[model samples]
Target: MRTTRRWWVPAVAVAVIAAVLPVTPATAQPVSAGPGPVVADGVTQPVFGYADAIRERIFVTSDVDTDADGALDVVAMDIIRPRASEQGLRVPVVMDASPYFSTVCRGNDSECKADLDGDGLNDRWPLFYDNYFVPRGYAVILLDMIGTNNSTGCPVTGGRADNISAPTGIDWLNGRRKGVDAEGNEVVADWHNGRTGMIGKSYDGTLANAAAATGVDGLTTIVPISAISNWYDYSRSNGLVTRANNYSGSLANNVTNPDRRQYCAPVRTQLGQGGDDATGDYNDFWAERDYLPHAGQVKASVFVVHGINDDNVRADHFSKWWYALAEQNVTRKLWLTGTGHIDPFDFRRAEWVRTLHRWFDFWLHGIDNGIMREPAVDVERLPDVWETHADWPLPGSRPTQVFLRPGTDGGPGGLSVRSGPGNRSATFRDTPTMSQATAIRHPSDSSANTENRLVFLSAPLTAPLHISGTPIVRIKASVDGTDTSFAGLLVDYGTRERFSTSGDGIQTRSTEDCWGEAATFGGYAEEGCYRQTVKTVASNPQELVTKGVVDGLNLDSLFVSTPLVPGAKYGVDVPLMPEDYVFETGHQIGVVLLGSYSGYSSRAKQTRSQITVHFDSTRITLPVVGGRQAAVAAGLG
Candidate 1:
């Protein structure tokens, strides 16, 4: 059913022919063109010869004029391909289109650079794609997204202009759009086979997700690492604003060219208005940036990777996107890690490269590598421990409801199915300044700000408890104010030092491991390696498993808010961050209920409100697999 191409043989011969071919001053000689020795991986010794790879620049036109200019904006692409491409050897393309190219430094050293000439080309490209992929018979294109680097436009953040920029480049590569060189000479991607794969991290990866959602031709696959599927989800969660006022405009200003600020002032003002920090409701602006609505249009297969504990992009972005893609029956695979905001290349280097190699080879080069036949999900259970499953959420996980009730002698509280009187309640004041650590620590001690939160704890587990999916917390409560914030945290209370993967998990730079065909290249050398990392360990007696927040006013809907009637009870469901974690025996599962989370919401000191939770009506449901059996065997169910 599948066909494989032996592109390697011809790929090697093209390198040899490059030696006799004439080259211009702008391009380097084909290293493979000269007679060397073939390496172990077949083809030529060093594959495409990284040292003699051809480097050039081109501009691809975008669909929007972000700066209000009459002409459409254009994105700048810096290309590094095997010299054999110039000798009539067609190769597939791997691209990373990012606005952070000139601003954020990538890799362990944090080395970032700007354009050498004013011609929209960088002297030093970030990351190791040029050094690694180019030598493997692929053309690596480092793109400067429109409005950043040497591109002609204003950065619109995740607006319409930003969403379509990268896809425009793919269109140009496939002959649907036009491109030009630095000298304004019309350029065409004749040397490429028109097959492309996009890969990147954070904003770079976000661009890939957006571009793939457009269903652009020639895009065979996309690898989005910790990428955002919806800009609205990035800035807000269930009606709760995560950043200060005008978050979008501030971000736009950070990426836009300083010289074009005056021209893009109106656009920035529009961004600020659309964001509407005063009322964190979903608007048309957010709708335009949401890729989930367009996920059905995606024609390319997807390989997604994300950190389960990453609060930066957060797991919600990936979880929701993955669900949508699944509904569309899209071919997909996932790697769910425990690190925060990190690339797999840094945490799981060897395996990441090997897996990526096969992924790209199968999709771009039509290699029958059987990558598509492997398990669809690879999840990290603990530090450096991984398991593969046929699908996510494990297969047979069931929602187990853990009810909440008052504790004896007026202690913190108790979590079980036993119901109590309906009128019994737990009261706490809205404290917006309390940290998550303080909220979970000494929860039974009423002396330490007990008035700010309500802590509910389950009995110590007799056996291991495994939670595999999103946990939902339902509460029946009434607030004293028209609007208030509600935060629910699922905590693991134990003394052992488990892998601290929440937030930016502890990472230390240590030894490096290199890959690829060779190490030396002229005066420039390429070592496709990064520092080894270890998860930060903590003995603090507790770990925040997952948390969720919501604005009381937006409980009914995210697009609109209805002020709550004071003292009138209302039921609200809060979905905690998805997780794949196991709680060992002797550990207690604790639920911390609070009014505010300063780290994830705007800081506004308002009149504190007294919130009351009906004891018998509140419950936390967890996706438990064989939990009842374990709990029963442990004598705790």
Candidate 2:
């Protein structure tokens, strides 16, 4: 579902066409054929161009009389124009079909192709032709939707049903006739009057946010990385279904098996199971293909790139699309990573392709540059830090509640920090404490049994406490076992000495569901009983509004990176992962807890074990900002 492949190929290999495209010359800005009224069906077969190589060509079309059916029927694209010195820009088109396994298959040892600037590195779109589509300038229009290299049709499986292939590639790039510019020139503004934007990651970024929620025409913006808004939560979490990884085996091999005429029949009826009403609760057909009630009909402007140890699209599905695009105010740009399922081949894919080339060069080439004046959120921290935030629970932050006493030396540096709701904690079936290192069980154990993890500190900063935002932990927990899952950590321990490393290498953080959820008698939602909810944020200032010129290379002093030498005492070690989650002394900061589900493990095991526990009365709210106007947004007043 979102992998680079590690093993498992029961079936899924049939996508070839290879080469036959060459005609390129429709390039934007042309579509005024006035003096009459022909709104809809007017494009029977105009556009052409398919060099496929020699500086790329793409821009194709179809219809040997679509319904007249003389038999031609096809379409193709791969545009990307603009930047010819930029003036009144208007340009912002990006389609990208992605899905080329190379003739029934052959590539992966590391290169299955399609590398659109993710920079694990691979290019061929406009040159060698592996074509993941990236001419970069900002006006791309690819569409091999299913026919492959030559471009025809038949391979569907996208969302919003009806044989979805991203709404037939967004209805042929905004209903035809005008989009070509890889040197064949053409762009005064046509691809539906310019201003379009959509980038993909997994299944073309899950149909570029359901084709911008069908608001249609000139989309305006969408990012969708490591996607899935809901296909039973993209293969169950609380309901269960996980079938052994690789995102449910690429939804079962490159999308269900449609061989036959070599690929088509709506490609296995647009990717298996769309019938008998596939239910799992959250209704309305998953509310019209769940991208969060169409995040307010998306009309563009949305960026959500994820990978918080993505065990296949589970960073809580990017915090459920960032709280449904912040409850429909929309305006979002978030890129969080800890690697584990694409989108972070280190250097966070060149800081996420420069925040996708300056957010499509300022909303599809409007280019005042300021990139919407940056700072909406940008977090990449672990054993290292880079922080930015203006929004995202940063407005007057104050959740403050901390407690977890119960460590008569059982580990966690002799734990003890008393305050509330106590019972001398330890009840998820208490039986932990004994670690040398071990937890990956299927039927094996080498003696690394440890639990009772609880660490909390906060009292050495009369001046340097910044904590950018969102880090909760309210464990009152209890479980005779009916289904429970936990994982939470947010370490910082400032001065104890040992500087250097301030974010982006991630020291300790394991994410797949993170915190528990389905125990429903109506208890344990947020305040203890396993309530460790820190929905993605190591340092987020709304990605510096919108990527603040590549997040201005953060690390803005903190005694120039932890130099408190004065009475010294800054600490924040949440450590929970002990079923074999090692990174060792990268200055300690780990969080790896599994058994996923809620209230206490019922059947959430992605293999990796280290049982034994008894930690009661654990509470951690921590939204805290503290005085001097909270270090005045880190400028230190």
Candidate 3:
């Protein structure tokens, strides 16, 4: 690493360069050196050459030992900006602090290789931010987050150390924190205006959410796509463990320095102990990582984008975060899609880039782009169509509870408003080996009539039924065992083909699609093209809408567990996955109840105990457009 002091270029030299440079859509006009700011049109600007305008360096953070070592950690920072910045033109910063730079790469690439050039910098930068934003008068910084790549320390997953590390970088840019280069020399950021915006996908985006939640002074806004708001929710649900392995310790070890893994053994042990897989209850460790609790501290505007059908992070994360931000009156916008675990770059390239440009300009550059005046929510209704609303769940939508009733004869149950016989009940044996697909299949299927699950169906809809928010399943049930896992699925039963947002649906290809102003550099592959079609392999007759799970011991609270007493009935409310979807006319809405879901949780020993649900006391509440009237018109009331 190398260090340098603040340096400035002569005003006269910049003026001469501006006079000779050409002005075109494909090339940036030279900016004159002056004390005042020069605003570049974010929509149209040339792609600046990386070699001419970019500089790479390392910034050793102030005294905060993430690895429990005596010394502080160093973060790798790579910057790209307009060359005119050296001539006194200050600009706002757009940053992405990520750990994947070394472990998994940023975009479609599966693995990231450490291909360093002679200058001790990565030859290829991840993502399109550097390729597109530098010419538009924004400083783009690619930081190898605190414990990965060239940064010194051990990764702690989403612990307090990891949650606060990225925000410290914002403090450094605002001149509040001290930083130095790799050679034990002082380094300073003299060119930035101290206003920053962060953006990324998945874990990279989670860092942005965490940093913004800190209420860091200079952070203007954040864009978190398919990001996690709580680590415990990502790995567990209501006392039910989703993963068998210890994720916190495993991920920490994966991102730590190869040679220093043994040195961080104690930290890994601490992570495993804090996770507490046996109970899966919320603790201080998860609370520190829960950004929702800290939303009140956020001053930065939030622009959220998430796939409604994303099972990995789940829509609950974004929905809960959005509601919390609303309570704090934080500026916010949302784009909900029908895709899963995907970035907007791959889902809708051209529109996303244009929207993002305007968003950054309005928040970071003080440009009135009318982005704030527009509708607050834009949701994908189907495969490629979109609908804009004043806010999420629509203004007129109401929560309507649809009751579950036993079949007239010896058939499956029905979803209706009328109550069934008081003595009617459905029983199923706890089977930990049943897959989600088998559990939710239509009751007519011979394979679905097993003793492991109970299926209920609604009559064919007379009109289209649209639901736009989280659905809750309220049930009165008794079990023979002390504790058992409960899984509930809301499904659509029809023959029409739909976008496959589930993980098992699609097989992406090696093809690409071109968008935006074309770039002719590096074989025309820089920011010009992305995957054309997120290929869909449709399922016939039935498709899963959303699912939820809970442990009987957690019926009262997620933070505390109380084992159920055998033969005692309990009323439990299980929140199904949040969704924005429409069931076409003639299609039926179905609900499936199972004892356990092997896909989302570890396979426990077979309980072989009977679980009985009282039909008259069980119901599901959905967010419908016109409440019971709409449901009645659709033959569901």
RMSD of each: 6.3, 21.6, 8.2
1 versus 3: better lDDT goes to: 1
Expressed as tens digits, the lDDT of each residue in 262-286 for candidate 3 is 9877888888888888788888878
Per lDDT, the best of the predicted structures is 1
* Stretches of candidate 2 exceeding 4 Å from the true structure: 1-196, 199-202, 206-222, 225-257, 260-302, 305-362, 367-389, 393-401, 405-425, 430-603, 606-621, 624-637
Which tens-of-lDDT digit does each residue in 1-637 have in candidate 2? 1111211111221011001111111344444332211112211111111222112334334422212224443444544343331333222356655544333322111222243443322233321111211222334554444444444444333433311444444444444444334444532233233455666666556767766766665566778777766554555433333333323224434532345233344334433444212222233333445666667776566777765545555556666666666676666766664443454323343354445656665555444345455676565544224466555434555544445444343333222233533445432222222121212111011121124333333333334443433444444333343222344444433223222223322333232221111211112111101111122234421111000000000112211122112222112222221110111221222122223322222223332222223344455444445523543322222
Pick by lDDT: 1 or 2, better one:
1
Which segments of candidate 1 are over 4 A away from where they belong? 1-46, 113-122, 258-263, 417-423, 448-450, 501-503, 517-532, 602-605, 627-636
Error of 1 at 336 (Å): 1.3
- What RMSD value applies to candidate 2? 21.6
Q: Which ten residues in a row have the lowest lDDT in candidate 3?
A: 1-10
Error of 1 at 216 (Å): 1.2
